[model samples]
Target: MLIPYDQLEPDTLTSLIEDFVSRDGTDNGDDTPQETRVLRVRHALSKGQAVIFFDLESQQCQLMPKHAVPKEFFD
Candidate 1:
């Protein structure tokens, strides 16, 4: 399921973005600051370039690029 970013509390959204960006391999060898990474993800979310996905089975939420998600999820 798609979770709207706007619906999340400010702190929750910040934590989520921080967690996503801090995951291994996401940094891509760049020494980008955590705050900058979080801002980039937040910008992507606001621009519709990224989305928050909630998996029913695992009950986990993930931040993914919009194009990477299945089209049906948008409906």
Candidate 2:
């Protein structure tokens, strides 16, 4: 269930980006990196084509084509 990053809706797209940045276990203080990076890499899926990366630790990327994540989870 792999999806190109561009296919995600705006909200879901934001969530996914946040998930990726946070998944690496790195924190950027009080700033939200996804807000900036999502805009930067939004075209990655269009020009270079980005693929969702999934592993044992996270389940969101593993389940594509399904909006399994709720907005509250991110809050």
Clashes of each: 0, 0
Model 1: clashing residue pairs?
none
RMSD of each: 0.6, 10.5
Q: Candidate 1, residues 1-75: lDDT per residue as tens digits?
A: 999999999999998999999999999999989899999999999999999999999999999999999999987
Number of clashes found in candidate 1: 0
The all-Cα superposition gives candidate 1 an RMSD in Å to the true structure of 0.6
* TM-scores for all predictions: 0.97, 0.44
Candidate 2 per-residue lDDT, tens place, 15-60, comes to 7766655655444563655666565555554564445545436654
Candidate 2 least-lDDT 10 residues: 62-71
lDDT of 2: 0.53
